[model samples]
Each structure stands twice: as structure tokens, then as C-alpha cells.
Target chain A: MEKAIEVKDLRKSFKSAAVLKGVDFEVKRGEIFALLGSNGAGKTTIVKILATLLKPDGGTATVNGFDVAAHSENVRQSISLTGQFAAVDEILTGRENLIMIAKLRHLKNPRQVAADLLKRFGLVDAADRRASTYSGGMRRRLDIAMSLIGKPQLIFLDEPTTGLDPEARIEVWNVVKELANSGTTVFLTTQYLEEAEQLADQIAILHEGRIIVSGTLEELKKLFPPAKVEYVEKQPSLEELFLALIGKKEEK
Target chain B: METTKKHFLSDIGVMLGRSMRHITRSMDTIITVCITPIAMMLLFVYVLGGAIQAGTDNYVNYLLPGILLMAIASGIAYTAFRLFMDMQSGIFERFHSMPIARSAVLWGHVLTSLVSNAISVIVIILVALIMGFRSSAGIVSWLAVAGILALVTLALTWIAVIPGLTAKSIDGASAFSYPLIFLPFISSAFVPTDSMPTVVRAFAENQPVTSIVDAIRALLSNQPVGSEIWIALAWCLGILIVAYLLAMLVYKRKAL
Candidate 1:
């Protein structure tokens, strides 16, 4: 498999404080590679560097075979980024936002591209409504749709479902899954462990600005021991029962 | 849409549309921009008109140019403020990730400021015309006035983008424009610099505002502009080139 992204000793520091300290990682093409970290763990910083939004102070990164610094535009052409929060222009309608990005990307039929993305994202109904009026999920869907204007080979979604309700979060998850299933490489960063488990084919846990662990789910499960160890106890807490019933629907 | 060579121009159009939408939604900035110039025009014409010896037949026309400059200076501050908010909001970061040109972002806003300031200028001119201020200058001179104003507006806009991008707080982003708004008062706007103290006159006559105000006054009155038009264009172009280079440098280094 081809490497979709590669980072070597990437270091970024704001002032005297370091955010990314000699980090290294890689993502294979056509895989959903999830980055799991807490807030301020430099997950977003890494994403920014890979997306060419922020330049790393030290070390180098490449995306889709283009160096982020030397060949920035080529890297830019191969990737799309959806930030932690929806960056949709509230003043523009959902359809306009999509078409605007399409035009920016120099697509031949911008309106048609926008309409197709809107329909695929299940946003056809709210197409003409101003994005400010849309729900958080709708705006986020529009943001992702905008990212797809150029049909990027790689997509970076930084905490894409952070503020959504449960149902809306699932909607985003489904969209992400579909993108990966269609051969697009997705680099996702989220604080939710369940989200990583649901979406990631290759999981990497970042701690204190470094990837402490990276492996497939089953490999990680073997290293950490069973998250739920089976026991023959006669009683269990109500919280455990509730967790089993409602917390993870597909973990079983 | 054609050749991506003109991508910057189209980006300006899109940015103008978005910025106008924001301004229309929040009418406070436009209202504030209009209020300052109109209030100053009224105060200068009604209260200070008789006392200040401008030597011009119509003080409103003479004062109109100054007030228009003040309006433009004050108006672009909101552009800085809005851009600052968009920067803080991560919208800029989102745009940067795409294949769009970086310069287009600022141009979008600079053009927006130009358009909105033009409207404010028109409103102020209309109000002044209604109050016995008339310009007999031909269409060519009017076009010259527009060209100068556009250059001035673009220069200040590039200057404003620096503070907007570099400022940490909302107040900090907009605070730099306060001095620009007050710059007109010390120039030939309110009174001729030679009538003031030697030091004050030195500062006033040498600044960009004096040349700009004098050029506009000459254009409106159909008088010989002498060297003031060239001086004004030089000042505007100088500021524009320098500010654009600096703003781009500041932008290139920004963490966004």
C-alpha cells in the first residue's frame, strides 16, 4: 500500500512552549487512520501541519507524495481539511458554500459538483437555506461537502463530531465511513475513544505531543488487555449495565 | 473561472459578497461609519464654520473632503475587526487548507472595504450636496477622485490587515485604527497647518492626510491641484506597497 502521509521528527513550538516534539507517523492510503488525543495534546497542530495550514518549526511532513513545505501547492491539491469546528460561512446558503469551494478549486461545473455533494450528504432539502440556520450537523455536513469539491485523495477531519448530538455524530460517522469505503484516505483526530474504535483501521494514541502507541484495533486490544474482562460475579453495578446497554452499540 | 490567473479577482468578488452579507446582517458598523463623518461634517459646518477661516466660498465642500477621508479611515477599522474575528474563528485556517490563493483572502476584504467606503463616501457627498456643496468638475476629475480614494482605501486596508492578523484580542485588532481615524484632525482638514505652531505644522504638512485632503478639495472645487495630486498618489502608493509587503510577511508567519 502507498503511504498517504509521512511525518519525520516533526516539531512545532509556539514561543518557548513546544506543541509537537519530534513526532513521527505515517498513514497508508485508503485507510481510516484515527488520531486519539485529549485537548491540547497537539493533535490539531499535527493535522494543521499535514494540511499545510501551519508550518512546523523543525522536521518535515509530506502528504500524498508532496513535501508540505517544498511542494506545498501540490500537497494542497491532493488533500482537503475540515477543522475541529465547522468553518462554513454562516452568511452563505449551504449550496452557495459548496459551490464557492468548488469554484475555488477550479472545478468545471461548480454548481453541479455542489448539488451532487449536497445530495450525497443528505443536505438537498436545506440547500438553499443560509448555513447559520442549519443545525450543527447540517453545517458540518456542508463543511465536509465543501472539502470534497476537488475530490481530494486524502482528507483530514479534526474532531469532526465534537459538539454534535449522538444521532448527528452517527451521521458524521456514517459519512466518514462512506468516504473511506470509496478509497479516500481519511486522517481523523477525535477525543472520543468510541469514535476512533468505530472508524479507525489503524489507531494511534497521541500523548503529550507524541504518538505513544500505534496499531490495529485487535493488536491494541491485545496490548491493553480486555477493556471488559469477563467475570463470573453474581452482581454488577447499575452503571455497568447501563454502559453495556446504551454506551457502545456495536462494540459487542 | 478563467485560467486561475484571475482567481484573485474572483476571490475578491466572493469575499465582497460574504463581507457585505455580514455588514448587512449587523448594520452597526455601517451606521457607526456614517455617524462619525456626518456628525463631524455637521459640527464643522454648523458650529465651527463661521470661526474657521478656510478662505473657500463654501465651507461644506472644503470640509466634505476632510470628513470623507475621516469616514474612510474609520470605516476600514471594522474591516480589520471583522477579519480578526474570522481569523480567530478558524475560518482563515479552513481556507488556507484549500488550494485558494492566500492573497485573495485579504483582497476580498480590501475590496469589500473599498466598496463599503465608497458607499459611505457617496452618502456623505449626497448629504453635503444637499447642504449647498456642489462640484462643477467634469466626469474625468470625478474619476480621478475615485482613483485616489480607491488607492487610499487599499493602502489603509493593507495596513489594517496587519493589526487584524497580529492582534491577540478583539480590542487590540481594532485599536491601531483609532490613530488613523484621528489623523485627519491634525492635517489640513480642520485648518491650514501654517496657521498652527511650527512643530504642529511640520507634522501636519508632511503627513499623507494633508496631501489627500488638498487633492480632493482641488478636485471638488475645479481648481488647479498643483503638486498635491502627485504627492497624494505617491503617499497612497507608497503606503500601499509597503503595507502589502508587510501584511504578506505577517500573514506568512501567522500560526493559522
Candidate 2:
């Protein structure tokens, strides 16, 4: 498989503190590669460098075969970054936000493109309302929709599900899965281990500005000793229970 | 190179549209921009008009140019505030990653400031007209007044960009405009510089605001602008070029 992102000995320092310490990793094209770590683990720094938003202090990163440092614009053209924040303009309506991105991308039919994305993202009902009125899930959906304007081959989701309720998180997960299934590469970072397990084709654990280990999920699991498989009856999770209870109360 | 240039213009257009929507939604920014200068204009024309003894009989005419400058200086604080909000909200990071030209984002805010400030200027002039202000200069000279105001707005808007990028707090982003708002008082905007103390007169005569105020006042009354027009142009252009370069430098550091 072709590599979508390749980084070697990436290094960055902010003043006296180093944020990325010679980190190295690679992500295959059309795969969801999750960089899992705790807070302050340099996941965002790595994403920023790969997205061409920040320059590394030392070493090299290439995305979609373009050197991030030397051919920053070429790298930028192939990638989209959904930052930790939703990054939507609060005063503009959801449709307006999509149109702005579409127009900026120089789409031939920006209005149609915006309308299509709104429908695909299930935001048509709220399309004309100011984005400030959007729930966290709606805002995240819009942010992802904006990133899809130019049909970039590679997308970065930096802590995309942070602070979201489980249902909203599942909605975003479904969108991400659909993107990958349709042949788009996704590089995701999250503090939650389950999020990585749920979405990543390959997983890398970042700690203290370094990738401690990285491999395909099966390969990573194989490194552990084999144990007897066991099964137990599963009850619905808390999230499912909460939804069921809420539905019952509303019906009554 | 051609595509980059093309993208730059279009990206600026899109960004301008986005910022203008914010302005339309929040009428408070426009209202605040006009209120401060209009209040000052009223105070000077009514209370301080007779005591100050400006050369002209109608203090509104004499003071209109100064108040207009104050309006512009105050107006650009919103530019900084808006830019600061974008930075805080992470939209700048999003824009940086896109294929669009980097400078286009700053140009968006700068152009928005220019348009909004121009509106505020026209509104102040209309209010002054109601208060018995008159201008005898022909259309060409009136165009000259507009040209100067545009230059002044461009220069100050670039200055505001620096704080908008570097400031840590909302107050810090906007507080830089206080000195700018006070600058007109020291100039010949309200009272003639010659009437001031020697040191004050020297400073007021040498400052950019005084040249701008004097040039506009001359053009409004059909008086010979003489060297003040050139001086005003030089000040405006000089500040504009320097601020643009500096703002770009800070922006590159912040964004990159």
C-alpha cells in the first residue's frame, strides 16, 4: 500500500520546552491511523506539522508524497485539518459557512456543493440558523463538512470527539468510517483508548513527544501473550441505558 | 504564480463576506464605533466650542475633520477585536492549512475595517451636516478627502492587525486604540496648534494626525492645502507600508 504520511525524527520546541522529540511514524493511504496519547502528548503538534500549519524544528514530514516543509502549498492542497475546536464562524449560518469554504476552494458550483454537503451531514434543517445555535454534534458535523469542500485525500481529526456525549461521538465515528470506506485517508488523535480501538486500522501510542509503539491492531495485540478466550452475557452499556430511560420518560 | 494570485483575490472576497456577516449580525460594534466619536463631536461643538475659539465661526466645520479621524481610530479597534476572535476561535489555523494564499486572510479583515470605517466616516459627516457643518470644495476636492481617509484607514487597520495577532486577552487586543483615540486631541483637530504651549505645539505640528486633520480642513473650506497634503500622504503611506510589513512578519510567526 502507498504511504499517505511519512515522518522521520520530527522535532519541535516552544521556547525552552520541547513539544515533539524526534517522533517517527507512517500512515498508509485510505487507512484510519490513530495517534493515542494523554493530554500534552504532542499529538496536536504532530498534526499541525503534517498539515503544514507549523514547521518542525528538525527532520522531515511528507504528506501525499509532498514535502511538508519544502512544498507546503502542495501538501496543503491534499490535506484537511479539523482542529480541536470546531472552528466554524459563529455568526454565519451553517450553510454560509459551507459556502465560504466551497468558494474559497474555488468550486465551480459552490452553492450546489454546499447544499449537497448540508444534506449529507444531516444539517439541512439548521442550515439557515446561525452556527452559534448549533449543538456540539451539529457544529462538529459542520466542521467536518467544511473540510470536505475540496475533496482532500487526507484528513486530520485532532481530538474530534473530545467533550462530546456518547451519541454525538457515535455520529462522528460513523461519518469518519464512511470517509475511510470511500477511500479517504484519516489521521486521528485522541486521548481515549477506546476511540482509537474503535476507529483505527493502525494505532500508535504517543507518550512524552515520542511514539512508544505503532503497528496494525492485530500486530500490536500479537505482541502480548496468548490467553484463553472467554465469553459472558453482555448487558446494554450506560449510554444505551440512558437513551432507553430517556425515551421511556418522554413517551410516558 | 498566476493561480496563486487568482486564489488570493478570491479568497479575500470570501473572507470579506464572512467578516461582513459578523458585522451585520452584531450591530453593537458599529454602534459603539459611531457613538464615542459622535458624543465627542457633540461635546466639543456645544460645551467646548465657544471656549476653544477655533478660527472658524462654525466649530462643527472646524472640528469635523478631527472627530472623523477619532471615529476611524476608534473604529479599527473592532478590527483588532474581530481578528483576535478569529485567532482565539482557531479559524486562523483552519485557513492556514487551506490552499488559499496566506496573506488573503489578513487582507479580509483589513478590507472589512476599511469598508466599516468608511461607513462610520460618512455617518459622522451626515451628523455634522445636520449640526450646520458645510464644505465648499468641489467634487474633486471631496474625492481628495475620501482618498486621505482611505489611506488613514488602511494604515491604522494594519497597525491594529499586530495587536490582534499577538494579544493574549480581549482587553489587550483592543486597549491599544486608546492612545490613538487621544492622538487627535493633541493635534490641531479641536484647537489650533499655535494656541498651545511651545512644546505641545511642536509635538502637535509634527504628528501625522495634525497633518491629516489640517489637510482635510483645508480641502473642506476651499483653502490652499499647500504642503500639508503631501505631508499627510507621506505620513499615511509611510505608516501603511511599515505596518503592513510588520503585521505580515508577526502573522508569519504566529501562523507558521
Chain A only TM-scores, each candidate in turn: 0.90, 0.94
Query: For every candidate, what is the interface RMSD in angstroms?
Result: 3.0, 1.0
Regions more than 4 Å wrong, model 2: A228-237, A246-252
Backbone clash pairs for candidate 1 read none
TM-score, one value per model: 0.91, 0.97
- lDDT score at residue B6, model 1, on the 0-100 scale: 63
TM-score of chain B of 1: 0.95
Clashing pairs in 2: none
What is the fnat value (0 to 1) for candidate 2? 0.77
Residue-pair clashes per prediction, in order, are 0, 0
A151-224 per-residue lDDT for model 2 (tens digits): 99999999999999887899999999999999999999999988888999999999988899999888888889
RMSD of 2: 1.6
Query: How does model 1 do on interface RMSD, in angstroms?
Result: 3.0
Q: Residue-wise lDDT of candidate 1 within B1-256, one digit each (tens)?
A: 1333567677667777778878887777888899988988888999988899888778898888889888998888988898898887667877887766777887888878888899888888889888899899999999999999989999999999999988899999889888998999899998878798999999999999999999988997899999999999999999999999999999888844
Count clashing residue pairs in model 1.
0
lDDT of 2 by residue, B20-72 (tens): 88888888888899999999988998888879877778889999999999999
| Ten residues in sequence with the least summed lDDT for candidate 1 chain A | A238-247
